[model samples]
Target chain A: MIWPFITRSLGIATILLLAAIGELLDERAGVLNVGIEGLMLFGGAAGFLAALKWGLLAGFIVGTIVGGAFGLLHAVLSITLKVNQVVSGMGIWLFAMGFVTYWADRYSGPLPMGMVSPSIHGLSPMFFIALAILFAIWFILSRTHLGLKIRSVGEDPSTAEVSGVNVVKIRYLCTTIGGLLGGLAGAFLTLTYLACWSHLPTMGLGWVALALVQFSIWRPPILLAGALLFGFIWQFAISPETIYAGIPAPLPVLRMLPFAVTIIFLTVISSERFRKKWALAKPAALGQPYIKE
Target chain B: MIGLRFPKLKCERIVILTGADAVKISALSVVISFMLFGAFVAFEGTDPLVAYEHIFSFAFDPKLGLPITLHRGFFLVFNTLAFIIPMAAGIWNIGMEGQFYLGTIGAFAVAYSFPDLNQAILIPLMLISGAIFGAAYGALAGFLKGKMNVNEVVVTIMLNNIAFWLVYLLTVGGPWAGIAESTSKPLPKNACAPMVWNTPFTSIFVIVVAILVYFFLKKTTIGYQIRTLGSNPIVAKHVGISAPKISVIVMAIGGAIAGLSGYHMWAGDPAFLMIPRPEAYKAIGDLTYWGIILGLICLLNPLTSVPASIFIGSIIVGTTVLVRRLRMPFGLDVLFLGIISLVFAAFQFFHQYRIRRVKVVIGK
Candidate 1:
């Protein structure tokens, strides 16, 4: 039971970790791409469509490509246009919802009705791809000079610029890459997990990832921990049969405990004492648009 | 982009914008939003002209689509006004969705308990219960923000998830078993707020409440402080006005107002569930992000939300009709709306702020 739960949780974590690592890079670069949700949704749809038309690898590539494109858009708007972070984030959500949904519907082909691609077996190629990405992103963020520059840019782009770092370029690259990761995560949901191209298919995973970012807080390693926690939560709890029985209805309330815990965690993290002492070193200028002027 | 005509000179316009400017800006935004929406429809293999005609006729058709459009707009208006209140006070409660869902469950719980109460009494009571439920939820975020300094956006977003699952459990597990996954039983007919007009344009209670809110914000001392805090929380704090307390109070008030929509939606709309239906939209219980969209369109003002909500309502109605008729995929409206808003914001920036470009001169 534990191994099965762990495997399922690990599978879930792998998906989230892919997104979280990308977000970490994004946050480290000081650009909070709140449109992560929309990015993921678009990625999921794109990946599903690709898989439906071509194959699994093609779907994965399309998902990543779509996600990267959105990341680039975020970089352009937030870094160049200097739009408000929240506003830009909202734009991402709206644009993804609108653009992908329309495209998916327009290009839709006959697979099985409601199914985007048939599964290979119990697991999918995208699932394995997600696991590989988790490690790849972890290595890139922790080990590479590019990663260091990206982190420095997030930490203090002004200082990084002074120190000869191409802060703008670094940010643009990281955000785009992060978006790719986010898209891959989304594609995994459609092509692997559900094997369907769904409208707004990523659901609230992007939002949950944002929360996980907070819970994990500046640690690449902790992405796994946070993802595992979340995986255990949304997956393990609230069996449908148990709910259908309706003997004790408070199970629904119990299902909320994980989300509620996020609230509690945030409250704790933001406490004055916590902020002063244990506050994760957020990219110092995180979420602020990069304005050269 | 032109070179700075007045190089090294300060560009200052001292004229204050009147209501006319505000009206014009909003009007331009509406017009521009539609132009973009037209472009979207054209992209979907449909003729823009025919689509517009269909949208207009369907929206005002009065028999089939008008009521549904207005019914849909009711929550948008409710959510817009709800978020705008605290937003005016400088508190961004991204958790309005969670608070809304809480209101749904709370009001539903109350109404479900007293099934035989008169519509008048039941509606008011359910609304009150909604207010209380939303207030409590808002207070949690406010308390955290006030005491902990955790960003309200993150906290509220998380809370929205919590609220969603909470409602999910209630619908599936508890006393009320909704027909769908994220819905609850419809309230008794008598439990609904009475329609102000026989037409589904707007609910009477919402109109009355909006007026009262406009006056309260314009006239009341607390409202003044709320507005003041929004502009400069630190300054308000320096003046010993208690920013944290105001944040809590304002957010609670905002949640309560938002809850009214949930209460009335369940009461009046053909209730398939305790919560608003999510046939096409993915996120059902959480209306926070959409509320933020409304907040931005209305500049965080409830008075503006009235018309803004209607405009947005029409967009949703128009888009829904188009998608259904065209078999367009879900959430196309969100994409079109986002692009339009970005364009509108970008244009508005250009309209208001002058960005001077520097030019270099070669040696003569």
Candidate 2:
């Protein structure tokens, strides 16, 4: 049970970190991708099906492409048309719910379950993929010129534009990249976590990842730590063996630890007086929609 | 137009002022939502005719369908009040699920302790006790938010999980253990509210409660304050209103209403008093969220919730009839409703903002 706990925690953390990191990028580029869950579902189905046809690499590539397309739709509606971000995100969710269920039912034979795309080391191949992607994202978001430009767009799009940063293009690219990461997260869920195609399979993970951003305060490094903590709470709370093993508390109550932590984090940070004093690091234009002047 | 136009004014910020056109917008929204919902149903690969028939059979037929549907409807209505009131106060009381459970547990505890209590005393006491239990649970979240600035959404969601476990722990350990499942003992007969309509779902308690709640919202100072706070807390504070205090009160009231809703469920359908099967799920009167959705469809107007619940109730009834008659799937009804909600939410945006792409003829 403990081993299973450790493994599950590791898997959950990986997926959560991927999604959170994607969201962080989008937020940093002044676009809030609230429809991460939808993109993930679409990605999961596309990637899973692609893996069955071609291979894992093909699956990953297909997932990224599909995800990029959805991101483009988001960017066009939000960045270009200037629709309300929240509503557009919700529209994306509705559209995905319709598309994925229909697609999953129509295409494919038996859905994949139990194992991820072929293993690299003792760990599932996804573990290595996640590690490589995380490092790549960290480097791209922090050290590179493009990363600086993206960050400045979120911080002050007007200033970034004045600096000849082509804010719209950078925002469009970052949002698409965010979608690609979101797709990878979903693909990992199907190919690694649950290892199956499911209806609303992502459950509430997308929303949870959004909350995780607040928990980590948008820092990529802290996102990893936050994901691990959340995963630990989730794993501990649902382990039936731990519940029956003379543990002083019921398991369901413990399952609540992640939510409690989120509430505490939000509460501590959102307090007016506290916020006014030493402000927590937050994406300047987190949920705001971009309207080019 | 009643020969009326905008009054001459220096400065006005009236965007979407109320008129008969508002009704047209809402009516259009409902139509659009239903169309979208129908498209989703078709995509699910079931003949919706069959599905709609099943729901109707369940809602109106004198058999298992009507009784259960009515029972569910009453509880849903009861829960909606609990949810909407707090929402009006600008607090998304997602903890209604927990509060409902607490209310049910509290009602059961009281009834079980004094089985011989007179019906006159027992019924009112059960309702009050349930309300108190719910209020207490809701107050915890409110207090946390007011004192700690904790986001209500996160706290309420967590509280719901806590409520689920709390019920599990208590029923497993305490005297509410059912004869079959280890849930609460059967609710005493004397504690049950008297029936108004000869139907299973229509209870005198539900109707009386609805009226009281309506009056409480429209004709009361607390209700006014809650509405004011919900609209703008900063303005409310400037006008010497304590936003936190109103929040606490509104949440408590919301919880109490929700608790009463749970109590109604117990009285209406004592069968649910038992714990769930090998899977440890408990309803504890969860018809609230759907009721709230229906309530929102009616523009969150309390008066509208009544007819909306019945109309939505009819749809549920209609769908059940379709299910058995047409051999459609069972859970597809909910999916249809969800699609409807999504459509309704989307259409609401369009209704609020009308887009007109026009060319600017500067030279002309």
Candidate 3:
């Protein structure tokens, strides 16, 4: 039973882990992609459509491209145009929700048969792909010169610019990469996990990914633990039948477990005593639009 | 004999605009947004002008649209105000949706628990309870942010999901479940506030409250302190203002206003307390985002938020009409809103800077 739970948790965590890692990268580069919610939804729709017509790999590629397009929009608005980051992020989210919903309504047909069957040892191949991506990101961020440049841009763009770093280019690149990951997460959900298209198939998982970034304090290893923790809680809440069939907990209460636990964890980690004991790993320039003077 | 001559360099300057120029820029941005949206509508194979006509007619028609528009506006005024107050204190109270839900639950609990109370007594009791519940909800986030250093954004988002589930459980098959299975029983007759001149009496109440909030923010010392804190928390703290207390106070006030909006939903126009269907709940939750946009448009001023709320309210009503009458897709309003807000944000950038090109020879 415990083994099954671990496996289920990993399967669910794949989507979140990928998205959170992407968000972590974006935030490290001082861009908060709140539109992850919408990006994921759009990715899900695009992936579903592409998967139906061509194949899963094509779906994933198209979904990543779509997500990247929105990320570019955000980068333009927040970095080049110097609009407020929060508003731009929210705009992307809202636009994605509307666009995807519209597309699904007009163009979608019946689900392709056998979409729900597991394709790789009782799990989707995307799980291994996600693990590979995670290790790659960790290597890039921790071991590469480009990673250092991205971090410098996020920490202080003006200083980075003085040191000959192209802040705008780095930010745009990071944001687009973040969007690619978010898009892949959405595709993973529809093409692998749930195996079908639904309105807002990402649900509120995008927001949860945002929270996980903070919970992990922008570190890859900690992020992995956070994602798995949240994924476990989420699966447990929604699939209580798998754990204990006879206990009659209210559905709403069960559904709320993940969010409630998030609140509790946030309160604990945010305590003044906790901060005193361990330094908070927030990016110095997170969420601020850089303007060259 | 060797003389070197240098060519003048071409320079570009960015000028910050002010006063009337800023207003003109903003107006232009609004026009651009409308044109962009019109183009989008045309792309959908509908005549933009015709679509606009249908939208306005459904929103402004006295017999069909005015009452609903006004009803939505009444609630939106409170919701927008709820956002504005905390925003004035430099806090993004994204949890307003949750507070609103809790407020409705609070009001419903009062009305349900004491079904025989007189309107005069029950209404005030319900309002106070609703406000208190909302305040407490807001204060929890405030406390975590102030005392615990939590990011209010994540805390509020999490709280929103929790609040929503709690409400869902209570209303759907729980103790407060009504005969409808998805809604609580209607408030007792006497407990219901009578409609005034074919609209909700709460409309008048909302107007009065809006006025009071405007004065409170404009005239009071605490209000001044809040604005000062928002602009520069460090400076405010240097002058001995307590940051934690102010955070809690502002959030509580915002929560109370949102709670009043929830109360209005329960006892106002369609005077019944129902848990929205899942899709409806998602749409309703998006209302907080709309309120944020309104608050930003109004620059966090209560005086301006009223008109902003009304404007947004009409758009919402118009969009619903478009979907129902014209068979448009369900989420067009949200798309349009996103575009409009994005344009507005861009306009805000333009308001701050103007591009000027200077002619100069370059090569030396």
Candidate 4:
């Protein structure tokens, strides 16, 4: 029971890790994207369809590419055109939710769960991919000169520009990479973890990832720690049938565990009093569209 | 290497829109959304123009769908205002979905308990209870946002899921089942919304509320304070305006209106007269999102929200007509909305900048 729980929880956490790291990169580069929710849906739908036509591997690549494409659209709107990031993200979400639902109904029937190989410790290679990506991101963000430039851009784009950093290109590059990872996460969600696609296969996990970015305070290693805890809680709450066998709690109520936890944890972590210390280092220019003069 | 000349695209932030230009931009947004949406429909192996014909026949004036569109508009207006009112204080009230649901439960509580109460008394009582429930929920989010600085977007979103689960618990054989397990017990038919002009009387009620909200933002002292707070918090702070208090008050007000819409949507309507099944949010349930979209579309103007609601309502009603006819693809409502929002955002760019064609020299 413990082993199975650990494996399942890690599997769930991987999804969060992928999406959150992508978002963290954007935030670190002084951009806020609230549309990761829709991006994930687009990735899931596209990945599932591609997998149906091609194979599992094609699904992953297509999903990532689709996500990157949407990310580019978002980048053009937010970074280039300087549209309101939140509204643009919300628009993307509404479109994705609608399009995915309609597409799923039109093109897909009940799908058989696809199988993946090379499961180490009962976790697929997706988990390793996530760990490796997480490690790489951690290294690039902390130890590299590019990391300093990104931080400088997030803190003060004008200053960074004066320092010779091309703020727009860096922001766009980060956003595209973020979208790529987000897409891969969605592909993994449909083609590997859940093994099938539905209307919203991620089920607001993208939002949970958004919350996780805040919870981790934008640090990569800390994010990993938080994802593990979140993963365990999510797994526990998602399986009320097993957990609440003796207590007889309502299933839907139990199903809301992860969301409820997200809200509770978010409030506690982000409350002004608690954040006075941690919010100090938060990206200063985050959510502000920089206009080149 | 030889140099070749080509054209490159550029934008200047100098071209500001005139009054007429604003209207043109707005029209451009609608046209682009329609074209993009139509392109999707055409790609789906159908005649997009023919599908639109069925929609217009159903959704426009002098048709059977006008009343339904207006009825839907009433709810969309309230939802829009729900966003607009709190917006005056710079608070984003995305919790209308949860607040609306709680209002239904609140309305259901009153109607179920006093089924034999007088029509006038019962309806008013239901409305009050609904408003109270909605306001309390909204205020909770507001309080967290104001005092605790919790992110309202995530909090409201989570609250929506919680509210829906609560609905599922109550209606699905959990002490509130009426004719079926998935519905609350019916309210007395006499408790229906007072109707006039072939639409819910709430149509008039919504207009009055919108006008009142417009005045509330423009004329009142608190409105001034709200405006100042929204425009600049540092000035508000110096003026001794309490940010948290205003946040809670505006959110509560917004929530109250959305909650009132809950009664109008189902409980107080002759068509429903009780909360019905969860059809992916239990009808008019997830429609709270339409308000969010409309709030953005109207640029958070309380008065503009009314006509905008009607426009959106017609589109939804029209698309719904096409969905029934099976001549058009489903999800057109959301597709249209997403396109509208995206186009509006894009146009916001155009509102400030004009495209400039620059000549570029290339090495070949």
Number of backbone-clashing residue pairs for each candidate, in the order shown: 8, 23, 0, 2
| TM-score of each candidate structure, all chains considered together | 0.86, 0.80, 0.93, 0.93
Model 2 chain A: lowest-lDDT 10 consecutive positions: A114-123
Indicate the residue-level lDDT of B210 in model 1.
79
Candidate number that wins on TM-score, 1 or 3: 3
Name the lDDT value of residue A246 in candidate 1. Answer: 53
Candidate 3, superposed: residue stretches over 4 Å from native = A1-7, A53-55, A105-110, A116-118, A276-280, B1-26, B271-273, B357-364
lDDT of model 1 at position A159: 81
Q: How do the residues B98-189 of candidate 3 rate in per-residue lDDT, one tens digit apiece?
A: 89888888888888899898888998898999999999999998888777777787778788888888888887778877776576656677
lDDT over C-alpha atoms for residue A173 of model 1: 85
TM-score, candidate 1, chain B alone: 0.85
What is candidate 3's TM-score against the reference?
0.93
Q: Answer with 1 or 2, whichever has the higher DockQ.
A: 1
Instruction: Please give me the total number of clashing residue pairs in predicted model 2.
Output: 23
For residues B124-213, could you state the per-residue lDDT of candidate 4 as single tens digits?
898899899999989988898888888778788878878888887888777787877577777777578787877877788889999999
Q: For model 1, how does the per-residue alpha-carbon lDDT over B222-268 read when each residue is reduced to its tens digit?
A: 88888888878878888778877887887788788776666655555
Which of the two candidates, 3 or 4, achieves a greater DockQ against the reference?
A: 3
Off by over 4 Å in 1: A105-148, A238-251, A278-280, B1-29, B178-186, B199-202, B270-289, B323-335, B341-364
Query: What's the C-alpha lDDT at position A95 in model 2?
Result: 60
Off by over 4 Å in 4: A113-122, B1-10, B14-23, B61-63, B179-181, B268-271, B280-283, B355-364
**Consecutive 10-residue window with the lowest summed lDDT within model 2 chain B:** B5-14
- Candidate order, DockQ descending: 3, 4, 1, 2
Scored by CA lDDT, what does every candidate get? 0.71, 0.68, 0.79, 0.82
Q: Give the 10-residue window scoring lowest on summed lDDT in candidate 1 chain A.
A: A238-247
